[model samples]
Target: MTPTLILAIAGGVLIAAGIYLLLERSLMRILAGVMLAGNGVNLLFLVASGPAGLAPIVGEDPELIADPLPQAMVLTAIVISLATAALLLAMSYRSFQLEGHDEVADDVEDAIVRRRAEADLSSEAYVDTSTDPNDDSDSESGGRFDGGRVR
Candidate 1:
């Protein structure tokens, strides 16, 4: 019968739906889930402040009006949530661009296996990075720079 009770039920329903959508494979559904959860939390804020009443007065014994605190709090929370959502969207777009898909990356071992296959196919042995093997003269025995001094 009360607004608080109504909001409680709504919040519960929203939370349940959000959880369901979050489990879905689609990216858009995930975003929708996040948004629904945010709204559900906002409803909780309003529900905590009791039903609407007369606005507070500027007096020693102030009238018990519907608290403005929750409304202001919800506004700030909404802005923060939007900013976070935008950042998540940008990251998702970048991921899609790089991988050509929106799905989560496969297991780490799968990538490692591909890397191992490429390594096995390589024709040359490991590179000799410290010195050039082509230098066959004893005159260049000093070798590469060792601690900034020619070794």
Candidate 2:
């Protein structure tokens, strides 16, 4: 197979594995997944940038020089990934220090919200109580309105 095809396959595999790991409840696994996905994306960017050629300099012919946009994008992606990884690591560390484990637990608030949603119950805040008989806006707008406009 061509080198580009090989790189593409490798990138795909990395991305797939990353996604799989990302689904785990462990914070460290999530961090690893993010890093893997970032590297995979970088690899994909390299593959998309076409074969390497002359350095993109002022005197170099545009056609003969490699595209710099993809390289710049990859660099930006790497920085973003690094920042995300650092944030995740910090969070994991804090969790470990506080809870003695890196595994994420289901949030109580989330569970409550899910139960409410499953029961098809709207919160008190969403229940509109317009006592004005002349106020047809709520009926027209399905109980949603913003500054006399339907939202």
Candidates in order, TM-scores: namely: 0.61, 0.73
Tens-digit per-residue lDDT, 1-151, candidate 1 = 9766887999988988888988876566777788888889888888887777767666534456667899999999899889878976886788788878665656776675566567673432233346555756523454453322333
Steric overlap count per candidate? 1, 0
Evaluated at residue 32, the lDDT of candidate 2 is: 96
Lowest lDDT block of 10, candidate 2: 122-131
Over 1-151, each residue of candidate 2 has an lDDT whose tens digit, in order, gives 9999999999999999999999999999999999998899899999998999998789878889988899999999988998999999999999999999999999986886777677676643344343575776557547665422233
Question: Judged by lDDT, which candidate is best?
Answer: 2
**What is residue 134's positional error in candidate 1, in angstroms?**
42
Q: Model 1: runs farther than 4 Å from truth?
A: 1-3, 106-151
**Model 1 root-mean-square deviation:** 10.0
Tell me which residue pairs clash in candidate 1. Answer: 142-151
Error (Å) of candidate 1 at residue 56 is 3.5
TM-score of 1: 0.61
